[model samples]
Target: DPAEAVPAIAPTTVEEVNTRFVVLAELYEHDIQDFHALLEGHEAGDERYAERVDISARAVKERETA
Candidate 1:
C-alpha cells in the first residue's frame, strides 16, 4: 500500500525529519535566489540562453560550497 512506501529505519521521529528538511532548505536558499536573478529580463530562446544557464549553474555551485 502507498502508506507502506516510506522506509522504516532511523530518523523515525518528526523532529529529525523536520531538521533534515531545514538543512536542505538552508543549503539551497541562495541557489534559488541566484536562479531568480537570471529570470529578470531574460528569455529562453535568446542567443545567450546557454551562457546564462551556465552562469546560473556556476553561481549555484559557488553558493553551495561557500
Candidate 2:
C-alpha cells in the first residue's frame, strides 16, 4: 500500500497536515525527485501522485508567498 500512499496538503486548520506531510516526506524521501518535479505542474486528476505533488507544491508556494 506504500505506492498507493501519496503526500497531500491538509487544510490549514488541520493539525495532522504537518504530521502527515512529514510522514510522506520520510516515506518518499528517496523514492523520487525527478518524478516529483515532472508532476508538480500536473492537474490533480492526472494521477494520485501528481495530485500529491500539486498539493505539496501549493503548500510551499502558499507559505513562500505569505
Candidate 3:
C-alpha cells in the first residue's frame, strides 16, 4: 500500500511539520521492510528476484514522491 499523502503546501506551522514527519517515518519504515524482503530473496537465490526488485524500485519511487 502507498503511504498517506502529505500536505502540498510547505510546512509552515509546527503541527504541519509534525504531520509531515509522521508520514515520512511511516514511508521509510515500509521502505525498510521492502528492502529486507528483497535482500532475503536475493540470499535464497529465489527465481523471483526480478519481481522483488521491481517491488523495491516502486517503493523507492513512492518514497521520492513523499
Candidate 4:
C-alpha cells in the first residue's frame, strides 16, 4: 500500500499541523506492517515480489527517519 498525507496547504494552523502529523504517523505505522506481511508471503521464485519487498523495506526505513 502507498501511504501519503497531504493537507490543503503547508499546515499553517496548529490543528492542521497536528492532523498532518497524525495522518503521517498512522500511515507509517500501517505501511510498515503491511509491507512486512507482504514480504512474509513472497515466494522464493517470485523475484518481482522480492524486489518490491526490498524496496518497500527501504521506503519504510526512510519514512522512519523523516
- Per-model TM-score on C-alpha atoms: 0.37, 0.30, 0.52, 0.44
lDDT tens digits, residue span 1-66, model 4: 234464344438888889989999999999999998888667544987788999999999999999
Stretches off by above 4 angstroms in model 4 are 1-11, 43-66
Report the candidate with higher TM-score, 3 versus 4.
Answer: 3
| Candidate ranking (lDDT, best to worst) | 3, 4, 1, 2
TM-score, candidate 4, is 0.44
Residue 5 in candidate 2 has what lDDT?
Answer: 94
lDDT by residue (1-66, candidate 1, tens digit) is 987997786536888889989999987997888887787546655758888889999999999999
| Lowest summed lDDT window (length 10), candidate 1 | 39-48
Candidate 2 pairs with clashing backbones: none
Residue 24, candidate 2: Cα error in Å is 44
lDDT of each: 0.83, 0.78, 0.87, 0.84
Full ranking by TM-score:
3, 4, 1, 2
Off by over 4 Å in 2: 1-46
Report how far off residue 6 is in candidate 1 (Å): 12
- Model number with the top TM-score: 3
Model 2, span 1-66: residue lDDT tens:
885697775557456778889889977875687568667757455787877899999999999999
Q: Specify the poorest-scoring 10-residue window by lDDT in model 4.
A: 1-10
lDDT of 3 at 39: 94
Q: Which scores better on lDDT, 1 or 4?
A: 4
